[model samples]
Target chain A: MAEIMSLSEAVTANVNDGDTVALEGFTHLIPFAAGHEIIRQGRKDLTLVRMTPDVVYDQLIGAGCARKLVFSWGGNPGVGSLHRFRDAVEHDWPSALEIEEHSHAGMAARYVAGASGLPFGVLRGYVGTDLPKHTDTIAAITCPFTGEQLTAVPALRPDVTVIHAQQADRHGNVGLWGIRGVQKEAVMSAQRSIVTVEEIVDELNPRVTVMLPSWVVTAVAEVPSGAHPSYAHGYYERDNAFYQAWEDISRERDSFDAWIDRHIRNTRDFSEHLALVREEGVVMA
Target chain B: MTATLDPPSTKATTDEIMTVVAARELKDGVVCFVGIGLPSTAANLARHMHAPNAVLIYESGTIGAKPTRPPLSIGDGELADTADCVVSVPEIFSYWLQAGRVDVGFLGAAQLDRYGNINTTVVGDYDHPKVRLPGAGGAPEIAASAKQTFLLLRQTPRAFVEQLDFRTSVGNAEGGSSRSSLGMTGAGPAVVITDIGVLRPDPQTGEFVLTALHPGRTVDEAVAATGWPLRVSDDLTVTGPPTAEEISALRALTGA
Candidate 1:
């Protein structure tokens, strides 16, 4: 019972202002197109969630779509620091951004607990660590079986979970291969979800059984080359140059604003945005 | 192909020396949970050298990643394509890591203490940090759960601090029964491979004791770099320079 729709329509209907949204993908299959749509629609006050908030999250944060970021790490991978994220914390240029941080293990456990319909997640974490001092979400709980103590984090039940996959059937059965992080748990843990796929086919022959049946998915949008800077498994290669170029673009506030305004805000859709990137001779390979 | 050229007498950088020291610690068939950057280089070098069967797990859920070239990040797509198997992130942490299946956890940190507790979270104040570092991703769990750990870091007074600004990963946790009291299963940091040399925790005190120094680096140099009053082993060894085979393999893998 999933409806295939346009990325814009999906974002408008599903993602809303002041909602907690998780765009989950490790590095591959990042829903950059859907994130751009959220920026284009001018959604604000959203608490964006991801294990690692790479370029897309930087764009969303830079565009002033996010009021808070609930994540583990926020950086431009391999290149350097996320300047916009740093600016938001230090200067609060667009707005004051609240941050709730956790380790990758803690975040994954929280999502698993949420998907499992549990009240809280338990793990051996935050011991001899200062994360508990900064964030209220992480707490220490005593083990009932033994007299041992462990870490407890609240379940992450987001308002909407947005993810990108390689392909999905017309019936909305999404299949993602390669490095799939916590997309399944993210989708299942959310109240509603939007999946942007590279293609919609009759059936899937995924290398592995990393598929989401139609029952759990809410909407499927066909956005080819959706994970532009990030790569889709089989569609294309990662644009490492853009990741390096982002360091320069995001360093200055004016350059960051100008880049986002031209590439994301000015373009109509992902295809148009991609065309602009290519037409400008930005080397993807 | 017939004529063999003599090994170059060119000197290696401190970084290369550190890399060689870290890579030599790995044994054949060890399961290593590798962090990005320096640890990745060491783990891959281990594979190309003696530990060919060592399983390299990235936090991105790629188990046994066999990248033909070096991966830029743990989440790089190239890691996935090259990996033996890819599972969900939850499974990677829960089943492989937290289950104590990982033999060696290789990590890097901004700051470290005598007890081996690492601080990758912040530099100064927690609330208003002088430098807000990339928060802990999986290092906490990896540090606590892996059977043992190997740390690669540059030796400096600021980095080898007396007290970490933040404890992103617990090593001995003030040493003694503290680690066991916290329900940590790992044996804590086994060895810290720095540019100056190798430091291993004393069995009784758990304070890192300098056991070896790299060529041209003296015990005084190591002690000067350490923030705490560093102790030296009575029978310390000046570690042998990188072997010809090790250097060749490392150069081939890293292409530097």
Candidate 2:
């Protein structure tokens, strides 16, 4: 069982530079409040692992919190283009770590392979394609038996994994409920785990804890509205205006730091990020 | 009652094979965690067919996704446009899957073993693994949480094998209820769909025993294509041939 900690404390204590931390959330839901806490703490040299993020990741990287990024796709392109990500991509900062672009399955499978202590997670999607170019961050090789060339995705063992849930207790035994076991891979790969949740519970019995309880989840914190506009999937509703605003800001590289300064760096609470959303109003869940 | 060996009624060109396999997994009212390629195709086909209500969720957070066709990968715009909602990857896992809401998770593997141990890695050892493979997306959770997992592969010696270089996702390790004791929180697989028909784990040994063969297929063909020696049930059943309605509808759907 982990000790009860505050949001601010967990963020500052666990996250470190050059740590390959798996940030929770996908494009918008469950906007990894823990990751936000990390950004606020000004943690740097972080490399994120994921297929995509709405703007949270872009904000983190733009704020100079992230030094390396890996995944199949990083930006929203023209529509909700990840502007800060693009700037970082096109020399926003000098020499960021490898920006890999492998298939989504391939990326997650590697992480799973690592967590399971397996050799490789076979993938058929990228077979005989240029997708191999992007996956070279791990590299590729030929099969000794058939001489068939295959992408070699090395094991992914994250130093820390920060996740969010619908509910959890001090020991970090979490229950995400339904349609949200997305962080299972990160949980599998991490050396240490921290679960941030909407509310704290008294007892997370084995009968109710969604994923297994035995994993060494180091700590827990109460985040009530952790996934405000970004929702916790079934628990809350989508914060479209926030996503829309994030998409718009991610369009131009001109105001990268200014955007973060006005939205994040200048704020102490959540409303400030929404104030820039242009909707004039965003109700926190 | 239908005698086998219906000749090669179009073995399915590679792309077509991809589409056929994809369409085979379509269903209605099922919740799916979608990825690109075979999984995407199958999920989309499910939506297009009777399973219009079938919801597709991507690791990127797009949910109730109804992509018109397969996205190049996870980032394709099709996923966004067709989705009923979108959230973070973590939410997709924590809330939807780990929470136990999703039903079927469509997966494509590089190689598979008798126990459903997948090798997405190489052909050799780990340290200097012979061929490094792509990593897992959300498949592990899909395998663990979905009511049951649906795997779609064209099938060949290289794919259907004796041993997977690596075990990317856990299927029926050591078979039976042993996984439960090992703390596997997710539901074990109920079935495995393949080009040859379908395979189910034996009741006692957990070794794969062939349950059915595609229309006209013989045991010899399936075993010949398998990389390792295969198994069969004493009372093997013949798999139904793709109905004309199925073939035509499938072809038109896939556009191959």
Candidate 3:
């Protein structure tokens, strides 16, 4: 059975230093609240994983929480480069960061393989590609049935997997919809999982794309607007303005630190963060 | 730059021409594994134009995403609401993409070689890159699995290189028999639609050669812009300017 806890409690209880963690979301339902809580707790030397690491990951990297990032793509969406990520790589302002990059397909397969309790995932990829040159995890294996050579990457079994969803029932069965990335697989692949939901209801509407039964989930935290900036399917719209604003906020070291200090470090929870954003008159939507 | 003897009927940007040229290549009802940005614009334009039934597959697991506007990124939630089906990411790659269900795979590149192999990984040294571009997303699998692939990029000496800094996606591997010997079933990079012209691989050599030029561009200019000793078609054809209908539909889709 899964326990219902506060976001801080969930992060404090679940996430630890030097753990391999995956905060999975495609472009929507990103676990920003959970990431903020992890930052608030100041967990260091963590390995962070995601398909696309945007503003949230940049913030975490800037705050000196992550020692490594395993991702396919890292950018600021329609805006531009992630300055903090660039700084960490180029100048090592906060710390020297390591990266293990993979394609979206590769990461997807690895997650699936991990969920299935397999040792590695296979795909018809990385042939004549430079990804194999940089990443040691990728290797070639011939298929047993067809004898065709295929690329293989080891299954990603994270220590803790965090995801944000639309809702969860009283029984701790979480439901999520819209641009469903590898949330389900990530949750199942990790040894421990934390799901931050917008609300807890008696009966979760059956329109969800995928659902996780109570037994597989470790903890469910009710953090409304958990996926702000990144939208929840039914709860809110994507804050394009914030995404646009983040370019400036994340560009310079001083501004980035100041913004994180004002918004995340100063706030206790997501609600307080939203209040700060509102008070600062930074339009969200 | 030599001025064209006959200008295009309507005012259109180079990016617009590139999109139209790429859009025309997509056939009706064909499933395209589309990358976000330029590919998405072209695919959506195709859906709004001649290929009304064309399907757009995004890596975010949205199959047949019919967005009202061009999505900002692959993970845009609007893609899901407007899509016909949304599956898990693993299912999207394993079942749909690697299963060889995709018909046309559209991609853009930071760098490309004469053989149409792409390099989105790095610009300089692999360990210490001069410019670190976004690494391969799904391009490697799309290049290997799709029945055919279409490359959309702004042609430049820097991008269209003799040799890539890193090959992130294979076009024809090295040359003829290379892809086949490697057991890659898909015909890699059938068409490369650039800002100035269209290039297709030589049947025997698998080298991308300029087959057609857009209305305002010249063959000599195209050759000059390419880093390799680009070959021109013996009987080069000029691609017709974007039709008003195509332009109107593109404008409607993009709202630009």
Candidate structures ordered by lDDT, highest first: 1, 3, 2
Q: Model 3: runs farther than 4 Å from truth?
A: B1-9
RMSD, model 1, all Cα superposed? 1.8
Q: Residues A1-285, candidate 3, lDDT per residue (tens digit)?
A: 889989899898999999999999988998999999988889999999998888899999999999999998888876767778878877776998899999989999899999999999988887777788789999999899988788899999999999999999999999988888999999999999999999999999888868899899999999999988899987898888898899888889999999889889988889999888878778763
- DockQ for every model comes to 0.73, 0.05, 0.66
TM-score of 3: 0.96
User: Which residue pairs come into collision in candidate 3?
Assistant: none
Docking class for model 3 is medium
> Per-residue error at A142 for model 3, in Å?
2.3
Clashes of each: 0, 51, 0
* Better lDDT candidate (2, 3): 3
Q: Lowest summed-lDDT stretch of 10 residues in model 2 chain A?
A: A122-131
What TM-score goes with each of the models?
A: 0.96, 0.54, 0.96
Tens digits of per-residue lDDT for model 2 on A99-202? 55554555665677767888765432343232353356445567789865445666667788777777776556677643343466777778877777777777
- DockQ-based class of model 1: medium
Taking all chains together, the TM-score of candidate 2 against the true structure is 0.54
TM-score of chain A of 1: 0.98
